[model samples]
Target: MEMEKAREALMVEEEASELVSRLDVRPHRAGRDASFYEGFALRGIRVDHIQPGLLTCSFKVPPRLTDSSGNLSPGAIANLVDEVGSAALHADGHHMKVSVDMSISYMSTAKVEDELEIISRVLGHKGGYSGTYVLLSNKTTGQIVAEGRHSLFGKLKSKI
Candidate 1:
């Protein structure tokens, strides 16, 4: 049943990617302002979908972001996973969310040339805390490279 849910989530992400491609607006973190992903050049990490508690993101792994093993660096994967998971909390609407805790487990290695799909869903949200689950997979093989759980604290930001 978990596998089925994951598969369904992937399908949703694919569709959302197509739709997002048509949008005129880009994410606030798409460029140099993306300090969280500064270690590696994050080409693009798009929020594919956000429905209620679910969120999905697609990413491209650049060769320059690899390690000596010719695989994507664990640090890079961890950063991406955290960004995607936190971004899920904001989705296309909510904002001013900060990650308070992030735990990642690497299951496998992903080659630098691999395109990755990251799917995140809110497990629970209450008061000031939000819990999220994220899965990172190689797009071609559907092999999961890493999974993460994040706890977020959110507050409304005052507009200047």
Candidate 2:
């Protein structure tokens, strides 16, 4: 019994080491370098259209972003809402703002390999503050996957 317990403890420690190694994200190497989490969540996203105050994109639910059950993870959903919603404000000009608040409602799930449509629209803007609405839906079934309201604030400067 003692030998078996020791073997189990060794296996658990090894598993933990492996998991930590996999989770170590590389630090940004340059000014334009995106953090690992950002790149991981945004990878393979394709912009379908963009105009002032409006942005639309298509994305396939990548397996890496999925949860244990193979459905798109909730954290990934929030990242999509935040990034895509921010772009709606940036579309009018290249103004980048810091997200002050975010509210998301997860209405449904998208599994790995499922196609999702993401749309964002600017609600309006005040001096140094703005709000955006983002809707993510299933591309083929037309089911709403999530809805998000993102609020941001910052000094607006035109930067390419």
Candidate 3:
């Protein structure tokens, strides 16, 4: 059931367009069944561009994504790393990818309502493993809030 839900949530272009149309008519609320990226979008993450092995994303930090002290949560940052990194690979021709290992290093903190710019790239791929990197920075100040590295296993769409 969970696998079915996940498969449904990872919509293709046409299904994604339909989902957007529905969202225009009503708010999206998938509750506990939403895919990770779906939940991230609900929290305001927006992808701006994709090219080859790179992607650019941004989001205005909402209060809902902050911790009790009113700073962006590490978990939220990590989530961005996972999604954006996979997106980079997808842009680079991978049809499916799963994280094998991810490491994040937080350098600073972002406050609620901060607009963050995230840049993610695929370092390279060898065999089934790919190395990816992500950097999150304050859009206005250019201060890096966090950086993350991810190792993933995936197959090219053609190969798949």
Candidate 4:
């Protein structure tokens, strides 16, 4: 029975991974001449790719983003996840998406200096409601650090 449960869990995770790949929308770094990311300090966060319903960003676990527990702070992880998810939506072009709601679950702790990868994928989109899933993992160990879901509302913005 345990084996069966484990297999099921693996299958679910695989499906989720596949879903993310299908969304394949690349991050938009060219529009702002890269200065925008620097201004926001998001220049340190490297975007791996963006798919239609998914996006991936990587970050180095710097001291400033860690907590006294010697692990990455929940708030920091949450914010990064939110940013990646929102970036996925805006990556197609240039627009603004506000997160209406976000819920994060910390599965494990990631220490400073750890390389972390965040994969954010859209779960669904209809009307004005859009749902996304974010998976945070320690790149070195491939262990899941956290996961989250976010709902967002988007509005077009004037070009700068």
* Runs in model 2 lying further than 4 Å from the true structure: 1-17, 31-34, 157-160
Which residue pairs of candidate 4 clash? 23-51, 23-52, 23-53, 24-50, 24-51, 24-52, 25-50, 25-51, 25-52, 26-50
RMSD of each: 15.7, 6.0, 11.0, 16.2
lDDT of 2 by residue, 1-160 (tens): 9999989877757776887788859888776888886687788889999999999999999998999999999999999989999889889674779999999999999999999999999999999999999999999999999999999998876554
Could you estimate the TM-score for every candidate? 0.68, 0.82, 0.73, 0.68
lDDT of 3 by residue, 1-160 (tens): 9999999888588866786676433354676466645755445778899899999999899886798899999998898899889889989988687899999999999999999999999999899899899999999999999999999986555542
lDDT (10s digit) by residue, model 4, range 1-160 = 9999989877757776896677535456676554533444454788888767778888888776677788988888878878888877766443567789999989999998899898888787766667788899999999999999988876444555
lDDT, candidates in the order shown: 0.77, 0.91, 0.87, 0.78
State the displacement of the C-alpha of residue 27, model 3, in Å, after optimal TM-score superposition: 14
* Local lDDT at 22 for model 3: 69
Name the lDDT value of residue 122 in candidate 3: 93
Error of 1 at 34 (Å): 6.8
Best-performing candidate as measured by lDDT: 2
Model 1 steric clash pairs: none
Sort by lDDT, top down from the best: 2, 3, 4, 1
